[model samples]
Target: MGRRDIDESDFHSRPTKRGSRPRTKQRPEHSDAVTGLVTGVDRGRYTLLVKDPDDGGGDGASGEKIVTAMKARELTRTRVVVGDRVDVVGDVSGGEGSLARIVRIQERTSTLRRTADDTDPYERIVVANADQLVIVTALAQPEPRTGMIDRCVVAAYDAGMSVLLCLTKADLASPDELRALYEPLGVEVVVTQRAPSDDETDGANSAGQTAGGMILVPESVEEVRERLRGLVSVLVGHSGVGKSTLINALVPAAKRATGVVNDVTGRGRHTSTSAVALALPVAVTEGSPTDTFDGWVIDTPGVRSFGLAHVEVSHLLRAFDDLDEVAQECPRGCTHLADAPDCALDDWIEASPEDERPARAARLTSFRRLLASRTGSDA
Candidate 1:
C-alpha cells in the first residue's frame, strides 16, 4: 500500500463518532484557600496576618498568626499591596520558614494612588482599602507645604476616603495657618505637639528615651487615637514631618524610627523606607479587663510630591458633591476651569448668599487647584 500511494487520511487513525475527548476547560475551585490581610511587602514576599481558628475564644478574644507568602503564578500581573485582603493557599500555619501562596486579592474598598510627577502617566498605588488618609504636616521645622497638602487631599477625595489633616510640631509653629487653608474644604484637623520635657533639653543624652522624650501619652495623643479608633487610616507626608514619630506614639510597639529635620535644609531624613500596616494597640480602660483592637494604621514612606497624572478633571469635580451639583448646569463640554465660558460654578458662587459665598469660593478654588495640578497649569 505504501508503494502504490498513501493518502493523508490513510496514514491516520479512524476518527471516533464522538471525536477527540472534549476538554472541560475547568479551573480549580481553590476551596481550601484561606483569607489573610497583607501587613507588609518587601522584595517579592508578602507578610500576611491570618486569624487563628480559635481567635474568638470564649472571652471574645481574637488573635492572628503572621504568615509569609509570595504571589501565585496565576496572579503574576496582580499587585498585592499593604492593606489588601487576599486569599492564600498552601501552608498557612505561619510556622517558621513556612511559605504560602497568594491566589487572589479581594476587592478593595478604596485604593490611593499617585504618579511620580505631574507629567508621569504611570500611577502608583499607595495603599489599598484605606478608609481615611491622614495628611501629616509639620507646623514648622520642614514647614508645612499647602501645595503638598492640597495634592494629597485631592488624592484622598479621588479615592473616596475621608481626609484628616494631622498637624505635628505645633510647638514649633501655630497650625492656624494650615488649618485655615483646609478648614473650608471640611477636612478635619488635629494638632499635636511633643509635650515639653526636661529630658528633651538633655539633647543627645536623651537618645535612649522614646521619641526624644516626647510624651507618647498625652491629650493630643488621645485625640488622634480617638480619630483612628474605628478607621483604617493611611498616614502620608513629606520627609521629616514627624509621621514616624506620631505612628510610634499611637502604636507604642511600632518602633518606627524617628528623624530630625536638618536645621539648614529644613527637610527631615526619610526614616521609613516602605509601607507597613501596623495594628493599633488594644485600648483598655483603667478598670476594664477586656481590650479592643482600635484599627489598622498604614504607614507609608514620605513623598516630596503627589502627582495626579492619572486623575481626570471630571473625577476631581465629582469629589466635591455640592460643586458637582452646580456643575451639572454648566454648558455642554464645559471644562469647569475659571476661564471656561459660562461655567455654572462661577455663577453658582456668585449667586450664593454673602455668608455662604466665602466657603463656596474656597471649595471652587480648591477644586480648580486640583484640576490644575493634573495639567501643571495655574489654578
Candidate 2:
C-alpha cells in the first residue's frame, strides 16, 4: 500500500498570532483529555487505555480511563502500534462501552520493524517504543528452534533493542543445557519453569531499571509481574512457542487464547492473531517492587517468516560495535561484502603504521570472519 494521504504538514504548525515567533498551538480543550497507550490495533482502529489524570508515575498506569475503537481515518498516520502512547480526544469515557478517537500520537523512541522482503520497499513497524524483544522458546511438546531465535536477534539488533532468549517449559527438557547454547553469545538467556520459587535461585533480574525490555514469565502471573514489572516487551516466536500462554499467564484476564501444539508439525495454530497489549498484574508480587506499576506485554501474532530486508548492511556491522575500527577500512561507497567487486578492506590494514598495524589486522581478521559468516563471502 502506498503512503496514506496524511499531509506531512497536517501536524505542522501554521503562522501564529505572534508573527515570526513559532510555537505549537494547543488543541481545543473540549477535545477529550489525557494520554493513553494503544492497547490493541486492528483494521485501522485502536482501543486506548487512557491513564488517570493524577497518575503521573507513568508506571502503574491503570486502565481507569478506557476509550475504545478509535478509527484510523481520524488518526494522522495510517498505522497504529499496540504500545504507542497517544493523545486522545472526545467521549473519552468510551461511552457505555463505545470507542473514542485517537487525535494525536506522541513521538516514538524506537520502532520494531521488518520489510516484506529484500524486494519490498515499504517499512512495516511492528511495535513502537519496544524496549526488548523476548524470543520465547519451549522444550517440551514443541522443540526449540534457533533459526527463529536468530531472526529475532537480527530484528532486535536492527532496531538497536536488546534481545532476551527465554526457554520455557524447562521441566520438559534440560533448560540448563538448552540455555547453554545462547549464553555464550553474551545474550541474556533466561530459564523459566512452571513452578517458580524463592527456594529455586530465580535468575530473572526483575530489577526494574528501564522501560521496554523483555522478561520470560512461566505459567504463573506472579512470575510475570515479578519479571516483567516495568518494561514494554514484545513477545515473539513461531506459533506454539507458548507466547500467548505466557501472556495469559502474566495478565490475569488478558484472554489472548492459547492453542495446542500439533504433535506432527510441532506448531500451534495462531491464537492471538494480532499484536495486543494488556495491563500486567502489577499487584501480584507483594514484596518485590517489580509489581510496581505500568507494564505491557505486546503479544504479537505468531511468525511463520522473518526477513532481513528492513535491516541494512550497517546494522550487521553495528552488532559487533567492538570492531568498528576495521569497518572504517572499507572503501568509500563500497558495497560491504555482498554482490560487488574489489572493495577490499585488507589494504587499509596493510598500509597502517607499524604499532597500529597488528591491532588493525587482528580486528580486521575478526571482522572479516564475522562478515563472512553472515554474507557467505570471504571478501
Candidate 3:
C-alpha cells in the first residue's frame, strides 16, 4: 500500500516551544490543607501525623492518622525537618499507597541547629519547633564529654529552647562531677540508672556521690517522663550515651535499636541513623490512665560532636540570666572574659557578698568556658 502523504504539520522537525503560556507568581493558597506534625523523613518522603479535623478536640488513636507525604515543587528549596508543623494537601487519608503533598511549612517557634565543627560556617538545622533540648550523656563506659554537652547547651540556648541534661548509666559512674559543672548555669539535670537486669545484681543500692557531699538518688524513666510530658524535647548526644535506649524505655513501642560502647574504643556504635518524633503515651496514675500529657520526643542519631560554628558568643549570655545582668554594666563589646580590660564581671564578683562570692566566681568561670569553646579555646 502506498504510504499516505506525511502530514508535515503533525510531525514537527523542531521541538515545540514549551512553557508558551506566561506563568503567574500567584500560587495556590491550599486553604483546605490540614496541618500535620512531621514525625519522620526518609529520602524524599515524609511521615506526618495529622489529626482528624472532625474528631473535635480529643486526641485519641482514631482521631489521629499517619500520612506519608512529599514536599511540593513550590517548596523545593525549603528544607523540612522532624518536629515541623507543615500544611499538607492532596491525598491525606492514612491508607496504603496514598501520598500527600506538603504545601507549606509553618513558621518555626524554635529551631535546633548545629554545624560540622567550630570552624565550619554552614549551619545544619537539626530539628524545628522543638521546645526542649535533652543533652544525653553516659556517666561511664564511653564517659561524658563536657565539651559536647557544653556545645549542645549553647546551641539550645541560641535557639531559645530550654536545656535538660539527661545523664544516663548512673550505675556505672557517679554524676556528681557533671552535675556540679552545670549547676552554676542553672541547667536542669536528670540522672538515670538502668535497673539491674536478670543476670545483674543491684550494687550498693545504686547510690552515687554528688556535689556538696550529698548523695544523688538516680531517677528512672518515669521521672524523665514527668519532665518531658508536655514539651517537644529532642535527645542529642554522642554514641553510647543511651539516647536510643531511653527512647525505647519511654515509648515501649518505639523499639529503637540500642547499641553498646566499644570495649576498645569506648565509643558507641551509631544505631539510629536519622531523627524521628514519637508521641508519648498517656500516663497511668493511681491505676487509671490520663490523656492530659501530649508531649513528644524526637530521637536523633548519635553524633561524635555537636558543632557550634553558628552560635554567637554573645547569645550564650542570655542562657545565664544572672551573668547577663552583670554583663550589661561592662563596656560595649565586652566579652565578659576574665582578661577583658575593665570587665564588669570582675567588679561584680568582688562586690558580691562574701558568702555569694564563691558561686559568682563559679558562674563566671562556667560562662567563660562556653565562650572559649566557641573559639576552640580551653577554659
Candidate 4:
C-alpha cells in the first residue's frame, strides 16, 4: 500500500482568542435588581413574585405580580428552588411576555433536602427558606406508613425546621393511635376528617363538631391554616395522601389536583409532577377578599422514598431533644443504636423516674427506629 501523507498542520494547536482577553474577577452589581420569592420552578424557568411599585396605578396592578425568570449564566451550577428569596434583574415589570434574570440566590434560612435512596450520595434540595415541614399522612384507605413519617420528621429536624404531622382521612380510620405515637415527640398533630354529607345525621364527635352540619371543608382545616400563616411551609407525603386537597382548602385559588390510592398496590397515583409555592389568602374565611398574605405553602409531588444519605448520625440525634442530651455522654463513635456498647441512651432511659421511665423508653425506641432506617435496615 502507498504511504498516506498526514496533515501536520492539523496536529499543531491553534491559539483561540476566546480566552485571550483577560477575564475580570469583578462582575456587575445589578443594584437595581429587586428581590422576589420563587413560586415555582419548571424546566429552566422560575416563577417569582415581586413587588410592583406601581401596583395601585390605573393599569390595574396588585401589590405584587408574578414574574417569570431564568438563572444568570454565572449561576449555571446553582440550583434555584421554590421558596428561595432571589434577586432578579432585567424586565421585572412582570408584564405579559416579560422575562427576568435571577442574578443571585440569597442565603437560605432552612433547606429541605432528600436523596434518591439511603445509599445515594447526591442530595436534592426540595425547597429553600421554608420554616415548617408539613408531613401529610393518611390514617386509612391507603394506610399510614410510619416509616415515611419518621424519615420526614428526621429530615425536618436535620434542616432545623419544625415538623407538623397532618393526618388525613380521619373518617376512614381513627387518629388516636398515630397521635399518641408522635405527640410525645413534641410534634404537633392535626387530625382532619372529611365532613359528612347532608344525608348523614348531625352528631358531635370527640372534637365537639357536628359532622353533618360541617361543610365539605375538613374540620381542622382552620388549624392547619393558622399554623401555615406568616411562615413558609412545605407539604410532603405519599401519593394517596390529601396534600393537594389540604392545599386547596387552605388556598381556594390553588386548585391542585388530587389523586386516589391504587386498589391493589395501596399507593397513591402521582398527581403533582413538581413543587409549587402558593400564597395564602389574607383571610382564608369563606367570604374573605382575594388579597394574599405573607405566608406561603409549597406543595411538592408525592415522594415514594425519602433518602437520608446526606444526613449524619449527629444531625439525626439533634432532632431528638430528649435523646440528644443523653447521647452526648455516649462513647466516642457511637451509632446510638440499640446494640451500641455502653450507649448512654440505654443508661439514661433506665435512670429516669418510675413515672417517666416508660415515656423515655418509648422515645428511645422511636429514636432507634429512625437511626436504624438510616442504615438501610428498614424503610
Candidate 5:
C-alpha cells in the first residue's frame, strides 16, 4: 500500500461518452467475469492478463493468462494504468484476441508519479502500485549523487514504500565508503560485491532457472535474474546508472540497447525506450509452491534532475517517522523552518542550549530550496 491518494469513485466510473459501435459485432455474454492485470497500454487500449476463469472456479489456471483488447469507450473515462487489476466483460480467448470492456478497476495500492521537469510539458506517471523503490547508482564514471539518492529515498518514504540503494560498478569504487552515505537512513544497500555462490553460479549459466532474492551477480545474466525474484521493484537513477544494462543482463534476450555515460557531460544516454514492467518468479519457501508472476520490475527513463517541490513539506518531515513526534510539538501553523515565531514548543528548545535547532530547521528548508530551484509553475 502507498500514501498517494486518488479519487475512489472514479475507479470504475467512465466519463459520459458519445460514440456508437456495431452491436452485431459484440460477443455473447460470458458466464462470469474474472479479474486480470493490465500489463501494457498502447494505441488507446490496454493489454489485460487474467488467470484461468474456469477449472475449479479458477481451475486449469495453467494456460489462462489471456491478452484481451480493451478500449476507453467501454471503460468509460477510467484511465487504466499499468498494474491495474480490472474485471473484464467479454470472451478472454487466449489464442485469439477479443474485445473487452473494463467493467471495474480494482482499487490500487499506490501510484508513482513525478512532475515533469521545467523543460517537459506534462506530468509523468512512472508506474503504479509498486512496493519498493530501488535507486541503482554507479561508483565511478558518471559518479554517484547522494542528493539524488536522498530524494528518491525521501519520495519512497513519503509514498510509504521501502527504499533500497543498489551501487553498481564496485570494481572501480569502494563499496564500504560509498555505501556509508545511505546506510544510516535504514536503506538496504546492495553493493556489487562477492562472487556468485553455488546456486547463483549455476543459475547464471542457465537461461531459465529458479533463483533466490538478492543474489550476488558478477557479469552474469542469470545471477541478476535470480536476485529479482518476488519483488515489485521500481528502478530510479540517472541516465548512466546501468538500469538498462542490468535489465538486459538479467533478461539476456531482452536485447535492451545500452548507452555509455557521456564522458564530457557526465550523463547517461537514454535506452529502455519507455517505462515497462518485467515479471520475475519468487523463490518458493515452506508450504507455498513456486509459480510465475511472483514479482515485477519496472524500469524508467533516465533523469538529470529530480525536483521535490511537487511534494509537500509535511510529507518530507514525515519521512523520518521517528522524528515526527517533535514536529507535532510545533506551534499551530508552523512551517517547521528556522526561527519561526509560531513554534509552540520554541521555549523548550530555547531552554535547552545544547539542542540542535539548525538540523530541525534544515529539514524544513528543503521544501523552500526545492521551490527556488523548481522550473515553471508547480503550485
Candidate 6:
C-alpha cells in the first residue's frame, strides 16, 4: 500500500554511473595569446601597446606598437579599462586599419575605484595597475576643496598606492594652508604657478606686453617630473582644478585642451572627456643611443563627487600603517568611529607628548572623517 511514497533521489542515485553527465567543461589553453597593455578605451574599442616578440625590453622602446582592439564575444561581461594588461588573439599587427580581439585580462596589481556619490552602490574603476595617484587641486581661481582631496587620498590608500598632492595656480594664492594640512600625513606636496611665457615678458617695442602671463613650465614642474619619473601615475580632481593645464605643461606633445574658470560660478570648464594614458618623453644623454620611456601619465575626466560607498573600513585602515598597528589594541569588532567606546586610537593619541598631540589628532580626525564618509555622513 506504500508503493506511492518515493523520492526523486532514489531514481537519480543508481548503481551505474554511465548515465551521469561530465563534471567539468574543457577550457581553451590560448597558449599562443599575445600580451598587450591597454593605453586607452573608447566606446567599445581599446588602444593597446603590443610588445614586440623579438625585442628584449629595457623600458619598452620601438619594439612596442599601438594597436586598436575590441573585446572578444566571450568576454561580454568583463570591463577592460585603461592600464589593463590583456591577452589578445587574431590580427595583433599594429598596422593601418588592423584590429584585434582581447580574449583575456591579466590579473591586476591594483585597481582604483570610485562611486558616483556616497549612496551609490555601483563602483567605477578609475584605473588599473597604477602605482601612484596624483591629486591635482587649484590653489585659487576655482578654489580647492579639502574634502575632495581627502577622498582622493583615501582612495589612493585603499588601492595600495602612494599619494601626491599637486597644488596648481599658486600665482593666485599660497599653498601654505593646504601644505600644512597634508604634509603631516606624509603626502608629498608640490606647488606650481605658471611661469611667464617669453611672449608676455619680451619688451622689444611691444604695443602691449604683460610682464607675467601664462607659461608652459612652472617652478615646481621639474620636481613633479622627478617624482613621477618611474611610476604609473593617474591624475584626478574636480572640474576647473587645472588638471588639463598641468597635464599639457608636463607633456608638451599631449596638447590636451584647456578650459577657463567661469567668473561668476567659480568653476573650471571640463576639458578632458575620457581617461587617456600618455607615455612620458624619454630623457636623452649625449652618448646614449637608446630612448627610455620613463613612465605613463593617465589623465581622467573631472568629477564633482568621488563616492566611497563600496569601500570597507578594513581597506581604508590598511592605508594608514601606523593607525593599523595601533588599532590592534582596540576591542574586538571595534568600529573606530569618534564615539566608539574604549577605542584604542583615542588613548594612543592622548599618550603622545604635547607637541605631537596636534599632528596625531589631525590624523585621527582625518581617518574618522573618511570612515564617516563610507556611511554617507559628512562628519
Best by TM-score: 3
Work out candidate 3's RMSD over C-alphas: 5.4
By TM-score, how accurate is candidate 1? 0.87
Clash pairs detected, candidate 6? 240-268
Per-residue CA lDDT of model 3 for 1-379, tens digit only, reads 8878877677855544683566689999899999999989999999998997766653534577899999999999889999999999999998999999999999999999989877888889899999999999999888788988888888899999998999987888899899889988878998887653332321111122221222223346668888897889999998877777777656655767766779999998998999999887655333344444468889999888778888877788877787788888899977777678999889998899999999988888888888877767757
lDDT of 4 at 224: 78
TM-score of each: 0.87, 0.69, 0.88, 0.87, 0.67, 0.85
Model 6 error, position 331 (Å): 3.3
Cα lDDT tens digits for candidate 2, 1-379: 8887877677966676776666557555535456878878877677777666655644534335667757435455567788888877666765676666666678988788876554567888889888888888887768887655666676787787877777777667887764655554446776565543343221223321111233334333354455565778888887877776566545544655666789888887887788887666565332544334566678889887666666766776787664455557666876555343544555665668999887666555444443444343554
lDDT of 6 at 121: 86
Model 4, span 37-135: residue lDDT tens: 898999999999888887652111257788999999999999999999999999988788999999999999999999999889899999999999999
Better model by lDDT: candidate 2 vs candidate 4: 4
Q: Tell me the alpha-carbon RMSD of every candidate.
A: 6.2, 11.7, 5.4, 7.0, 12.9, 9.5
**Residue 354's C-alpha lDDT in candidate 5?**
62
- RMSD (CA, Å), candidate 2 to true, equals 11.7
lDDT per model vs. reference? 0.82, 0.65, 0.81, 0.82, 0.61, 0.81
What tens digits encode model 6's per-residue C-alpha lDDT throughout 1-379?
Answer: 5667688756855545787676666657788989999989999999998987767663545778888999987789989999999999889888899999999999999999998887788899999999999999999888898888888888888899999999987888999999877886779999777655556442111211112346534336666777888889999988888787667656655667777789999987888899999876554223434256789899999888898877888998887889999999999999999889999999999999999999999888878877776755657
Minimum summed lDDT over a 10-residue window in model 2 is located at: 202-211
Model 1 spans with C-alpha error above 4 angstroms: 1-26, 57-61, 199-210, 282-291
